[model samples]
Target chain A: MTWVYAVTLLILLISLIVGVWRVIQGPRLADRLLAAQLFGTTGVAVLLLLAELQSLPAARDTALVLALLAMLAAVAFVSRVWKVRPDSEDRP
Target chain B: MNLLIDFTLLIGILAIALTCLISRSLFRSVVFFILLGLMLAIGWIRLGAPDIALAEAAIGAGITGVLLLDTLGHLKKTGNLENDEPAPGRKRLILAIVSSFTLVGLLLWAVFNQPTPAINIHLLVTEAMPESGVSHPITAVLLNFRSYDTLLEVGVLVLAVLVGLALQTDQQAQDSLPGLPNPLLHACLTLLIPAMLITSMYLLWAGADRPGGAFQAGAMLAAAFILLHISGIKLSSQVSHRMMQAGLLLGFGVFLAVATSSLIGGRPLLTYPEGGAGMLILLIELALTLSIGLILLSLFTIANSPPHHKDQGGDHGH
Candidate 1:
């Protein structure tokens, strides 16, 4: 069980890394926002797995809190991106 | 056998995460990420944490999805979504790879090295289950024993909304619903809204007896709102009116009211008076589920960006 959890987390971390690449390499702000949202989602999964490792219920609550906060962050980022960038059609 | 299921679920999660990270279209990535959240919710259940599972399904998959879709919409309205030339950065790829390895190494080391504890307080709560009216220890912890945490959590949620409002667009007049409409979409909304309401009520009522609670209930209500949005039914800012606002705080309010009243009786806050305590807890949870759901949905709706065209091809309400 522990091995599976470990491997699963490892794969999730890899995905987050790739997402970080997108965040940096993103040509448009939307892509960066998407990458950040991906990171947040993966963060929630990581927290849940950690909770299992520690056999702690509070960890799950923390994960829940993180998940909610991540969603909030995504919304904030999107709004910010929208405010900063002009519509694509406006560009030459 | 259960471990095998766990392995399979993990694989599914990995696939979704990879897709979410690498999808060509930003809108499609957001949709996939929401699906990924749902898959992760199932993963939580496989790991024997139904409380986490329920909460994830509601907030993680349901409300978060709406917010993402909303952002995608906003991007669409701005016409900023496009596959442009890659930013001048091959160095970023190297940095991402190196940091990813660093992160995984740290996680593996910590998971392996951490000493397992001998006793878990959750078990203690289980043992003392008879003293509390609630059957589920987590619920008991959430609403009774650790009711203070639950109260503060709701406050955190409210604060997040306040902050989100301050940070995001203040377009109170522009409804957050998707623009397009389809007959099938309408059918789904008609079917799902009632189911959401019933399930939310059931979850709140059964919270003391089972795995449901305010968080789960709030998520369900949020899910219903998401369904409404995707179907193009916009909720005005006044969606949750004055009574609705009060009801949204019902869980915390009742808990505080009962807890304070108990002070006169020389009891701690959230202390139940023997047999009648279960009803009080249920009432609070029910009101809270309603209030929390509305507040969360309102937060996402207000924060939601208009949908971009490409997001339409992604998963629909699953």
Candidate 2:
């Protein structure tokens, strides 16, 4: 069980590194933002794994909060980008 | 294996921070900055500090991302974003790299040289936990052992919103993005908002025995309100300024009232009567959750607002 958790966290860490690489070579603003979103998801997974491995329930709570707020950046991105574009329909 | 994980995270965090600093595009850099916050949240969890991790994920990564993205949007609109992001010349880039490495070296040196003989606060916190208002050590510390600090922390949040609102009042009203009128989004909110609210309230109430607390709960609530706003729910307009003001003050007001009432009881300020500390702390936490939520929502809304042309005739809300 401990080894399984370690492997899971290892995979997450590798994925995070890959995501940061994507951010560095962003072809567009959206791509960079997507990498950040990936981080948020991966982070929750990693937190959950650690929570189990360390027997600390607080890490699970942090994961829950992370999962809950994950959409905020994406939502803010869409709203602000569209609003500033000067062409959003008035939700008719 | 643990060491390897820590080393990898360390490298990843450092690389992301450097990338955020030197990324040629301001927008890209801000996105990287948000990513940095996310990575830092993970690091905090690894260090066994879930309270800090929750705050980092919520406020550090989530809210900061919103504010930075909004600022980038404004800069893009004014054409300042592109103009100000001229690529660094080779010499300047090298200088920046050198200086950053030196700073990192200094930090590493300090870490390695730090003495470890200081009293262990973990033990102190644990020793006091049963007597403190909350069973959770961090909660007890924040609201009971060092409650005056918590009171001031809430005050600082209040002051920040007021200052931000003051700076925002006469500013140009930026175009609000139309919350897309889609049944899916509406349906999602119907389910999601309730869950978010329930979780936030549970977090507040469970704080006595768990890792959650008013600040995390408040931040979650604020995120919920922002989510609602983005989904075409016009909560800000429905809530009159007077009402908003009342909501903003509710947390601070309740805290101050509790503190003063204790004073009237002939105890020192903020000292609850015997066996009443738990209930008092819970009450303060409840009001604080509401006020903090409103303050954060207000900041979110104000940041999204457009800069008004100084010559345009606009009515200030203040």
What's the i-RMS of each model? 11.4, 3.8
**Chain B TM-scores across candidates:** 0.81, 0.86
Best by lDDT: 2
Work out the TM-score per prediction.
Answer: 0.67, 0.88
Off by over 4 Å in 1: A1-92, B1-5, B85-88, B116-122, B165-172, B176-184, B235-241, B304-318
TM-score of chain B of 1: 0.81
For DockQ, the strongest prediction is 2
Docking class of 1: incorrect
lDDT tens readout by residue for model 2, B1-318: 888889988998888888888677777777888888888988998898888888888888887787777666555554345535557789988998899899989999999999886998888888977778678888888888889999998999889988887787545554355565668778888888888899899889878887788998998898899888766686767888789899999999999999889878889987778888898999999999999989988876776555456623432221
Which is the leading candidate under TM-score? 2
Fraction of reference contacts reproduced per prediction?
Answer: 0.02, 0.68
- Please report the TM-score between candidate 1 and the true structure: 0.67
Model 2: colliding residue pairs: B172-B308, B174-B306
lDDT of 2 at B234: 67
In candidate 2, stretches whose alpha carbon ends up further than 4 angstroms from where it belongs are A87-92, B77-80, B87-123, B171-175, B304-318
